[model samples]
Target: MRKCRFAPGGIYHIYNRGVDKREVFISESDYIRFLCSLYRFNDIAPTSNLHRIAYDVRGLTSNISDKPDKRKRLVNILYYALRPNHFHMTLQELIEKGIEKFMQKIGTGYTMYFNKKNKRSGALFQGTFKAIAIESERYLMEISRYIHLNPLKNIEPEFREKGVENIDKAKDFLLHYKWSSFLDYVSIKNFPLLINNEIHKGYFKDASQHKDFVFEGLFEVKPRTCKGIL
Candidate 1:
């Protein structure tokens, strides 16, 4: 079946798994590299040496800017999480077809780096990746929570099998988890290029409200409830 196309300005749950469900991150460094690539591609850092040439000067100079000499460009990173074999992200597109370009850059850039590092051939991901547009503001928040909770299913399966007294502590483990955007959301660790602070803050109109939502969602649902999404 043909997959759906991502629309500009739409919030999508974008994800991909390793081929054969194998471990994509063999070491902690691999995870860091992958996350760095996300920020790098999203224009998170000041244009890299090459990016400065490709998209900044030569690349954009041809495209006329809407504001006099200023070139028109749109791209931003919203939220993302990294796991062993898979990853998830919530993105807001700023330009027409920006999502397509962004994903292509990330995929191609990471694959080259991963293959060279591991001395492996072929693709790292299973396929072209999947994206589901978040239909409501409610789902937007819900899915973000879901993405952050993915690592729990992998690292702390016991929290689900046996009831833990300190559910807050279990959730705290997630807060400190460096592999996902959970840290970014809480502002404990800042990943400047990985996410757009302005757009991300908009997800939580009230900090207390968002925290309650995440906490309640964690406890109310059986921990095993995440099996499917993971």
Candidate 2:
């Protein structure tokens, strides 16, 4: 486990990978389930079990249309991306131990559901999730790009180190990727209710500029610096 203290009002990059780098999301349903967990497990108060709710409503559309229940949130999820084997999030802790509690709920709850569904046992994640504090505005913006561009690894395994090979294809893939908040951040509003984008709204003039920043700006950033603090 990484040693880092989470503070209220502080932004941190949080992530965890599957055990042995195996796939955590196996199907479309699995991806949707994980996304639902992200929305349902953010509360400071104990709420209905997502697994039970999902079981009860099996075969129903996983698109959660209900408004997030009114309650104090554990953390403000500013940005997130769900990859095949891991997940990434940029969160601002709103209360004491907010990030810790939120991660615990999602981690434990998802692991339990996944194990039962797959008929497997033992730990699902590699270990304790990693948390890195974002120390500057540049780092914050850069980290968002890094997280959003993660899906590109599927087409270009070395994209992070070498940048996108086909800029057009990369942009298309990112625009269509359903598992990340890239769409919401770009103003498409896939799950606008789950994010607090005010902090990042001013960074880009509009969605087009943000798209350029992601696909173009990344190429200009040196690989070493682009890896960011995390």
Candidate 3:
């Protein structure tokens, strides 16, 4: 695991993969459950009775924030993609270590749920989650666009290959995809129980501007990659 700066109000690209190359999400239900955890951190529901009977479990707990007295919510989900073996999220940290704390809570909560539900044990993820800070406004918007376009690489590969020509339709697909925060960013839906509103709104000027910004990047954007700490 690499060391990351836990800066306040910072935007970060966080990601992780499943143990080995095994499927992190085997079905639509599994993906939905994970997405629900992202939004409802500290409020995750307990595993079902059927899940309890399948495997021994431990470390189960609520997904609530640790700083009960903090007036403002920390960690805003800008965008996310739930893939089969890995997942990615772009978030703005409202409080210090908010991303770390949020990920820790969900990771612990989900491990127990999965162990029981799948009749498996041990760890679910490879190790600690990785995060890369977006140091500039340019990177922030571009990274968020990349995160949202991830699912389209699956559903509309041809469009992606030709560049973001049909991104409006892609945006529509994102809105319909229940597992991502795309809808939250676009103002199509709101899930305040799980997401921070003010922090999210800070990501864009407006939906139309955001859409145009993303589409422009499709043709001229340079590929950016990160290795190790941000």
User: lDDT per prediction?
Assistant: 0.65, 0.80, 0.63
Stretches off by above 4 angstroms in model 3 are 42-74, 156-172, 190-193, 197-203, 220-222, 225-230
> What would the TM-score be for candidate 2 when compared with the true structure?
0.90
lDDT of 1 by residue, 1-230 (tens): 11656666777778888899888877876776666556456642333433223223222223222224232334556667788888888788777777777788778877776788789999888888787777787777777777766677665655444544577777787777777766656656545345665755776775455556666655644544334554
lDDT (C-alpha) at residue 123 in model 3: 96
Task: Show the colliding residue pairs in model 3.
Answer: 39-194, 41-63, 42-63, 42-64
Q: Of the candidates shown, which would achieve the greatest TM-score relative to the real structure?
A: 2
Ranked by TM-score, the better of candidates 1 and 2 is 2
Stretch of 10 with least lDDT, candidate 3: 53-62
Q: What is the C-alpha local distance difference test score of candidate 3?
A: 0.63
User: RMSD, each candidate, Å?
Assistant: 7.0, 2.8, 6.6
